[model samples]
Target: MLIDTHVHLNVQAFDEDRHEVIQRARENGISHMINVGFNRETIPSSIALAEQYDFIYSTVGWHPTDAKDMTPDDLEWIESLCRHEKVVAIGEIGLDYYWDTSPKDVQARVFREQIRLARKLGMPIVIHNRDAHHDVVQILREEKAAEVGGVMHCYSGSWETAKMCLDMNFYISFGGPVTFKNAKQPKEVLEKVPLDRLLIETDAPYLAPHPYRGKRNESSYVRLVAETAAQIKGISLEELAGITSRNAISIFGIK
Candidate 1:
């Protein structure tokens, strides 16, 4: 069985055939999927999807791009959702300097607040680091994020940055990008990440892997990622699947 450690099936991209897409994932051997909801609109939809599917789980958090829009009420809402059995973590939260939709300071503060919330609730986080790797690692360090740990969602940073995250007790997650031929850094990093701390994902409707690159992505495509990861790790596909699925389950506290 395979588990998609991170996905965005809750978003509008799958509104036309979300169930069909999920079924495809199941048929493709995806035993479970973690649907990440980063903001107000997606969070409830994510939880609803989780409640409907026994194999699906949800994570609640605010995206850095929308940092300017988040208020105290939103933070409270995320905290309340943490009590939901289907909500496994607080995340998809972190610095996104690429978009810069929100000011740097605002993003940093909001990121810190959610990290503190995750720490308080004793839940792992799902980080989204973009061009702000330095600031993201710095803030994570200052906030002592190691106490709770997390997954660096769709990690695109260098091995140096990834090593820092690993040191902070975070798992390094790879997605469709790792399947690309020119994705040298991610492949190299994936090779170096310990099997127990390594995870694979599709980041559906976003980073579609090669052969499906530039096309809309779905969870079913995670098999391609697993195959590439297995090849990179020099293990059988089944072994890689088992290893990554266990890593996802362990980090997310999946029951």
Candidate 2:
């Protein structure tokens, strides 16, 4: 069965037909999904979604863009949420220089605190780095994030960056952008990244793959990502799906 390593089902985009979307994904062979909480407000909502769905799990932490609003109490709240039964990781966190919503220093501080939290709780992480590769890699190393290895969600970095993350025992996740016709870098990274170090996601209601690009994404569309990787790695689609699913189970400790 396939697993979407990162999704945002808690967002309002799926409110209208969330149940049907999930059912369709199950029918399409998606057995599990990891819903990521992006900020202080989304954590409870994300956890709620996980509790409601047997196959859904969640990750809680502030996204880089939302880091500006985080406070001491917010960190404590997130720490508390990490103790929830269905919360498996601390993330959708990291650096995003592409947007100026949060100051760089604030994002780094929040990112480091969350990394420490994940380590303290013995949970993995879900990183979101955008155009801040150097600092992100440096911070992860300095923070000893390898202790709570995680996935670099929607990875859009170079092979060198991916190799560094892999060396730190982190899984490299590819999303819808990998399927775009002009996505040369991700395609190269997909080919170079060892299958064992790979995970696939849709980041639903966000980046839908080609043909489905510009439309709302869903877990079922993860098949397109698997197909893309298969073509790049010269493997069968079934083999790609099986390996990626196994990798997800291994990383997230999902049953």
Q: Would you give me the overall lDDT of model 2?
A: 0.92
lDDT of 1 by residue, 23-107 (tens): 9999999999999999889999999999999999999999999999999999999999999999999989999989858999999
Steric clash count of candidate 1: 0
In candidate 2, what residue range of length 10 has the lowest lDDT sum? 36-45
Clashes of 2: 0
* Model 2 ranges with Cα > 4 A deviation: none
Residues 91-203, candidate 2: write the lDDT tens digits.
98999999989999999999999999988989899999999999999999999999989999999999999999999889999999999999999999999999898899999
TM-score winner: 1
Candidate 1 versus the native: TM-score? 0.99
Local distance difference test scores for all models: 0.94, 0.92
